[model samples]
Target: MLLTLDLNDQRPLHEQVAGAIRRAIAEGSYAPGDRLPPARDLADALGINANTVLRALRELRDEGVLEFRRGRGVSVASLVEGRLAIVLRLRELLEEAGRYGYSREDLIEMLKELP
Candidate 1:
């Protein structure tokens, strides 16, 4: 899979990395048991610090979207339940944004400005 980080983006690199991985999982690009690349390797591939990659991995682990074992490396977790919950949360957020008079374009622009 191709992972990218935009140096020009206002959001931190770690958040972007985590978002990429999360989107991959949500879109079925990664399965529950799929293994993720090592932190150092992914860092090299993305031209970022290894610590940044690790931080992203840790965020996913904390969110129950990834599992990290001592020797097994990181892998996508069995997040079927979490997946549904996240979908529901996103829907709710979209509805909330609409209620606040935020158009879809406005939401997209706001997300683009996140940091």
Candidate 2:
């Protein structure tokens, strides 16, 4: 999977990494049971510290979005219930956008324009 990170963002590095992975999963770029790149490799690719990637992966694991194995690394968790986790995550995103001054109408307009 192609992962990108913005180091200059106000959000923590680990959060950025985790968010990218989550988006990939939500958009079906990475399906359930797909193994993510090793922490060291991803860190190198994103120009961030390996520990940051590890922490992000751990957060995903805690959220049940990923499963960590002893030697196999992290794999995407199967979808819970019948829908993609994006349903709940989109709510959180909308709430956060509202906090950042995006009106509901503005969000709706953006969504309407999405392919």
Candidate 3:
């Protein structure tokens, strides 16, 4: 999968990385149990610090979308069996937006309203 990060954007680099990976997972680009690139390799490819990639992976892991192994590195979590994972992801995103002052109504109107 190809990932791109915009350094000029206001969002943190790690967030951009996490979001890209999340979107990829949600869209079935990265299947369950697929191993991700090493943090150092991904960092080099993205022209960012290795810690940034690590942070993104850690966040994904915390959100149950990825898992970290001692020797196997990070792999996508098994989420194909249920809708709970998707619901949890949406809750997390909305809660995160709330932290930045976005209300549910605002998000619904902006994101849910059809064009």
Candidate 4:
């Protein structure tokens, strides 16, 4: 429920919302099978339009990070642990790589060479 958005972020509002939700899930704040706040509530909390939040939620669903249920609303995907772990680690890796002068493009190139 504690989603933060940077006023200076250049990403679309929906992407920023999705990123905040992803971080929340990665940090164990919202566990697998947990229901997220409704889009209107999230919109109010994040000061974004409800449609934007809904769009983000839909994207998360498509990414397998979240599940949409007719009566249950939106919940974290039951099998998201493995995926979330990778996502969280990837973020950390990218941040550390930044400090070491490795651009994301550089990391992508390295990964492309993996066996």
Predicted candidate 4 versus true structure: per-residue lDDT over 63-96, tens digit per residue: 8999999988999999999987897688789979
Query: Which runs of model 2 end up more than 4 angstroms from their true locations?
Result: 80-91, 94-115
Q: For candidate 3, lDDT tens digit of each residue in 3-60?
A: 8987787879999998888877777778899998899998998899999999998988
Pairs that collide in candidate 4 are none
**Candidate 1 collision pairs:** none
The candidate that wins on TM-score is 4
Per-candidate TM vs. native? 0.72, 0.73, 0.72, 0.83
Task: Give the runs in model 3 whose Cα sits over 4 Å from its true position.
Answer: 80-101, 104-115
* Native-referenced Cα lDDT, model 2: 0.82
lDDT against the true structure, per candidate, is 0.83, 0.82, 0.83, 0.91
Candidate 1 per-residue lDDT over residues 2-94, each given as its tens digit: 788777978789988987887777777888889998999989999999999999999878878899988999998876557745754775688
Q: Candidate 1 — worst ten consecutive residues by lDDT sum?
A: 79-88
